[model samples]
Target: MLGAGLAHAATPEAYDPWPGLVQDIFKSRPIHDGSGVIAIEMPYRAEDAAIVPVTLRSKLAPDDGRRMLSITIVIDQNPAPMAARFELGPDANVMEISTRVRVNNYTDVHAVAELSDGQLYVAKTYVKASGGCSAPAARNADEARGRLGQMRYRQFKRPGAAGGAREAQIMIGHPNNSGLQMDQITQLYIPAFFVNELRLWQDDSLLLAIEGGISLSEDPNIRFTYASNGAKRFRAEAKDTGGHTFRNEWKIDDPGM
Candidate 1:
């Protein structure tokens, strides 16, 4: 969420946010076209503006020798365009990442990848959505409050995958309020309160970490593909804007089998 405050709404025909976004978010760093190095998958038209699915996939060869350091997701038309930044752990070998986001307007969504070699690559996709940032919470206040800070994790085998490839999902229970929505009863803007930081680890080794902001959907679910490191345990820790920290760990049924 580095460029959170710099975003402004712009129509697809009247403006392009990528150039300014590059300067603001990347400090005018050169952004190479990510035609082959990375790709973004998203719907041209979102059925639900508040929970539009987006996925980032890495196309680097295993022997490429340059690991993906981090990826920044930016939705140009959102009030806070910098949705999330994901830092990949060196040993994780994460190949794919999927998450839900709030799209405030019909805009171009950009994914910028910083590789170990100190170069930045970018890919873009356009989405047709509106009013997502100010959309009402998915759950009512009472129910949302009850599930706050709760977390869940699930692992799945990657079909025809090699090199110990696996897919996993992590979900956190949160309202992730954007502060832009008006309370139906009170008619007041809800203060922005969301899980701003999250980290995942396999035993002592780190897997991934996310710096998030108001542009993400409620509940913040993330599904990713990574290579197993033979670690016996999986752990997650999340911190919200309210300063509450939620931590959990699970023992792997089979370590490196």
Candidate 2:
């Protein structure tokens, strides 16, 4: 029940509705054929366009020694195609990430990965969703403010894996109201309020930082990895469009043991 896509349109001459959007972000570099190494998953038909879930996974060989460095997500044909960018740290085992975004129309979502050596791989998913950017508000402002900035983390360790790192998931509490959603009573488009930025850390060191926008889901959920096998303090800090900041931490006594 996951939808995935690979660009196998015969040649680069294939017409893209938004021609320069991809090249605009990654100038000069050609998007070579990519498969197996990069994977993307999403619902073929999004139930709610405003908060559609998307997951990207990078299959890397432990011997290859090239850790994932960062990921850039582009939603072609959107008002702002550049949806989000994730900058990861050295031990940032961000090989796989799960988050949500707003898909304004039926278009392709590209997940571009930048490996340690600077090579980039791309995976595309064609999603059929619309009106996410102009949908009605799911909740009122007063109710949303009460649960803003709340976050928590959960760690999961796989058995018999390469063991280079362990995986964990973090969920933040925020209405992420895109302001595009209309308030029924007031009949007004609520001002866009969303998580704008995030930084994940292992103790004092920055593990990764993410830039978010209205495209992100109502409550942003992130799954990533970090060096494991011992105790580590995982911290997450985030800021919202409303000028509010959130800080929280998780203590892993003995991870991936």
Prediction 2 TM-score vs. true:
0.84
Task: Itemize residue pairs with steric clashes in candidate 2.
Answer: 179-190, 179-191, 179-192
* Global lDDT of each candidate: 0.92, 0.78
Q: Using TM-score as the measure, which candidate wins? A: 1
State residue 49's C-alpha deviation in candidate 2, in Å.
2.0
Query: Which segments of candidate 2 are over 4 A away from where they belong?
Result: 1-17
Cα-based lDDT at residue 160, candidate 2: 62
Over the full model, what C-alpha lDDT does candidate 2 score relative to the true structure? 0.78
Instruction: Please give the range of 10 consecutive residues that has the lowest summed lDDT in model 1.
Output: 3-12
Off by over 4 Å in 1: 1-13
Cα lDDT tens digits, model 1, 3-113, are 554444332357777789888989999999988788999999999999999999999987798889999999999998999999998999999999999999999999999
